[model samples]
Target chain A: MEQKKLITYTAGHASVRKQLLLFWTFFIIGSFTIGGGYAMILMMKRYLVEQYHWLKDEEFYDMLAISQVTPGPIAVNMATFVGYTQGGVLGSVLATLGVSIPAVAVIIVIAVFFPGFKDNVWIQRFFAGVIVGVVAQIATIVLDMGKRQKWTTISVIVCAGSLGVLFFVQQVSPIWLILGGGLVGLAVEALKPKSAGGASS
Target chain B: MSFLALFGVFFKIGIFTFGGGQAMIPLLQKDLVVNLAWVSMKEFLDFVAISEITPGPVAINMATFVGYKLRGLTGALVTSLGVILPSFIIILIVATVAHTFRTNLWVSAFLDGLQPVVLALLTYAVYSIAMGGIPAWWGYVAALGILLLILKYGKRLNLFLVLLAAGGLGLLMFR
Candidate 1:
């Protein structure tokens, strides 16, 4: 009876250990993914694209485009994709947790100190500066996506026209632009088969 | 609803938000705003705006804000966790299965083809997002200049500062 009980306990411990090991390995893998639209993307840019070389320049650019185009936060999706590609289910969990860990911790701290710095002039000033950085960061990703995608002439025209329409016609929904642009893209491909490889067909 | 129920809603958000958080918009509008009547459209709009302007994941922000609105801090916690749970679960399952097919050429080719379409979508998204906030020609100029700066340098400028300034300026001038 004693031996059986010991064996059961040891088995439970071993299984738990295996699960945790899997989780941690993925977490390490997750740490490498550079998320789209994330503050960490900026902070880790050098390490990822520059130092680590986990994502090639072109691949990084493509990843940026995919993440942004998809309906979710570009960062999370990008992270998940990388994690999944590299480590599978365990990898994804690790990546998601690794990326989220920082944000979650920060939020918890902020919440704990609810309105902690609301009236502090200096904190406000610092945060305002962070906003400029964030905007610059956003601009960086957008440009990176454009350069990486290597827009065709039709795409350029579509972009310019859409820019105008969106700017001038505030009432027009952005969704319309996305749908119309896609349809126009199909039309352009159909018309200019030689130029763009005509992928639509 | 209880905190657990709120978590369940977020879990649903995470699971079916297929494309990502923006995809969650209509679902969120339908379920949270319409069916549940958890909050008003105006408030929902406010949440959307906050999501865009915040630093982390937009969906996470929306979940946090909405949760807070419905059930205070605890509600916020449950909803935020819930919204991300599906992605975690799905990705885990998908990742495990992905190993067998990662090297398949057809899949690779399909992904390659999807790249350009994704780029098209992103280009469209950027134009849509940037064009709205500023009206004056100078405002456009600032945006363009910002774009150029980002391309030339990097994300060195602080984000929070810019928003407060923009909001303050907007309040001062427009309001």
Candidate 2:
């Protein structure tokens, strides 16, 4: 029965051991991550793509994109998405719990014991530096993700134009850019001939 | 505040917050500080500061911090659960739907379009962080150095250790 169950769920890529690994992976990410949700992206890429090879680059990027559009913290959204991909509902629960426990536990400790620690200059300095490191790591990941995309004329225009608006305007919500990108994609799909002319640049 | 109220407020916050940690700040200040008056302005500021410096998602940190301040450990638990619940439910539904229709042509095309835009957004994050976070020449050097280190070492290097080393570097230089 146990062997049969493993075969059944392996079709979805969930095993008890892999589920446990998912929990443990997210637990560690939840514990050490600083800065914010974006920082967690690099960590997730490292674990899921580079280390465990659980997700391919394309699929990982897909989840990253989805996590952005969905409401809430990107890290938690990602944990839920990746967990579900691996283990269905049960995987999602365990992974979400894994990522969330550290924040809850750590904050409770800080609140109950060391509310004044935020004022500590040394700790501030330390985190100031950690921010630098986080930025660097994220920069590297962005470069890598950029390199992987099959950039064409339209793709480059959309990417660059959106990046410019996001960086400079500061008022435009990202949702518009995302929706616009989808529209452009659909437009391209609609225009393409139903033959081998799909390679239009 | 009652635990249920605390949970409900956080759940509401969760449903509204898009983007992530930084985006949630204004909403939190508005809801908790301005509207509800659950925390004083100064306390709210302190919570933001603490959340910034601490490990984990800013949303989780802020929810936990505010919740604990209001009602202690149980409050923290409730609030964190509340904040997470919306995203959990939404992602589950979205993921399930996407999984079911992944092979459909339209969905794939939409995702393909999203890919470049997402890449652009990720690039913008790096640019913004560089502008806001890096103050000096050495900071750039440090960033570049770390990038090379990661590229060379790949998964063999531990990111946490890199962070610790950067912290030490900050102390040595900035202090």
Candidate 3:
């Protein structure tokens, strides 16, 4: 008949200090990560998985997979996933806020100080150089993903087919390609022998 | 544009666009620059460059930059919230369901299907950026150099250092 105390029930959970630490970790990673979400993946792995041991390597990959399949930036998705898994919804909110703060501050400053920033030759040259690095970063991601696949004949065909569609077609949306690839995968999966089908990776 | 309109447009951009930051460019161009005229073409280009060089997702950075341009700080906050809100909600839902469906056949198949398509998208990202960014011979050389450096060093090398080295190379060669 008596109401249980909420504080006592939640006592074993992470303290606010630990939550704040989670926030700061994401904030620092967000502040330092340049290029884009793909680049952020590598950083997240290094800091969250490798350095801190907050997440297991398999769990991190699973989150990365979910981040890709779902909509939104990988960085944001990752932050939300990590936070939720670690500290629940509050963790999610805090992590997202932390990751966003640095970008907001930097952009605001740039907007104020550099109204005519685009015309600056030095900035242009700097980006022209950074663009190369960004491309390489994406390339590295592609290689990393490619290496992860089990590489069956069906997968090889799917990879080539998707690449051809993307390369040759002018106006096909990636969303459609993604959906089609899913169908192809479903069909391939359905047709495989039961014994072989047991090995889903 | 009104605050509501700004939020609406960015929210739409957030949900509909896939393949991450670079993939949002044409959509942003069409909706914000061409249709609404909230941002100019030149400003959009500059925003793209700034977003790339800055420390967050391009989509979020663009949202903040444009939001500030339109309505100062409130605009920045509102637009960023708009852009990230969809992903946040979607990911929250997916994360919730993912554990329950971790071993489902259809789910695994769908994810497996996504693997190649994701690869294609990444490859396309590399191709598109290279087409636009690497116009000269030196640009190609620089790209090749960075790729080799990453391959050799793997994760041992810090990306920031690689970027800084590329910037230095750009200053010397591009100039």
Candidate 4:
């Protein structure tokens, strides 16, 4: 009877081991990802939900939604929020720090050295190519978003109008476009009939 | 720049930016490149490329790189802290009340409106960055080829490898 009780306790309540696992998991994810924030979503879902079963699919997605709605980088938000859920404040800190290690170390190295060699012709050529790759990646993201959107008249107008405004008025900050969109959305929602019952598609 | 001013700028950027790291690009370009002349547009593109190549959040990477450029190691630390603090504090609050927050009508409505605008801004970023980054005719061809490969292969093709390959190609082409 005592042996059975011991086995169960060891299996279920190894807090330190769980914390280490959490830290390591985030560290691995952080290390591998190239694009920041939005790019990490798939890996997060795969590791956190499918592999470890730390969160349900719905739960992972909910966190994603919340991350998007809130400020700061989505990657940081996910690390902090998911860490909190799994291991409290300590877990959050460890996970955040784990994820941050690569960015800090790598950027510091480049910051120290890259500027000194900025004028090198070969290095400049390599970066010029890399920027092409970056542009292609952004193009992919734009394509993906375009496919996902449900283009209504209002949404089309809003999108095209903002693009045109930005094109013409180079000095107009994007802050205004985002804020204006929100206010317009709020006003539309308020004007809707009570019987409408749900958000407009 | 002084540490306090650096921290202050990043902190404001951290709080003001919504959507994610990509969304912060326009603001960063406006503030850092256009207004302050801290880094030129060419250098800013370099930063973006570096951020994409490195691990962790792009926002954090940008903070560190820009900070280090301006003020060395301490600047990097301060800017990172500035960008991170808002998300950390905000998430703690939201995590406790996620259900309520998700169900809030006003929030959903606001996001719905913001969505289209965010798309426009992202598109603008692509345009602006591409204009400056891709000067040669072959560069555009390279970009198009890469875009096709990514679209066709999807996630099966790793981006890091693709970038490294492009660098190799750049060496040969530009030579």
Best by TM-score: 2
lDDT of 3 by residue, A133-164 (tens): 87887787778778877687877887898889
B100-124 in candidate 3: lDDT tens per residue?
Answer: 3446667667667767777777788
Q: How far off is residue B113 in model 2, in Å?
A: 1.3
Which consecutive 10 residues in model 4 chain B have the weakest lDDT in total? B95-104
For B1-175, candidate 1 gives per-residue lDDT tens digits of 8888798887877766544465677788898989999889987876665455434566776787777768877887788778766665554454345443214433333333344444444444455444543434444455466556556654454333444454454343331
Q: Which stretches of candidate 4 lie over 4 Å from their true place?
A: A1-95, A111-115, A196-201, B1-13, B16-75
Clashes of each: 28, 0, 0, 0
Top model number, DockQ? 2
lDDT of model 2 at position A38: 87
Could you tell which candidate, 1 or 3, scores higher by lDDT?
3
lDDT of 2 at B92: 89
Worst 10 residues of 3 chain A by lDDT: A3-12
Q: What are the per-residue Cα lDDT tens digits for candidate 4 across A1-201?
A: 111111000012228877788788888767766556654655576578767887775456446655766788888888888887877777777778777777788889877766554456776677667667767776776676677665877778888999999899887666688778778778877986766334422
Instruction: Give lDDT tens digits, candidate 2, residues B17-58.
Output: 776767888888999989999999999989888887788888
Can you list the residue pairs that collide in candidate 2? none
Q: If both were scored by lDDT, which would come out higher, candidate 1 or candidate 2?
A: 2
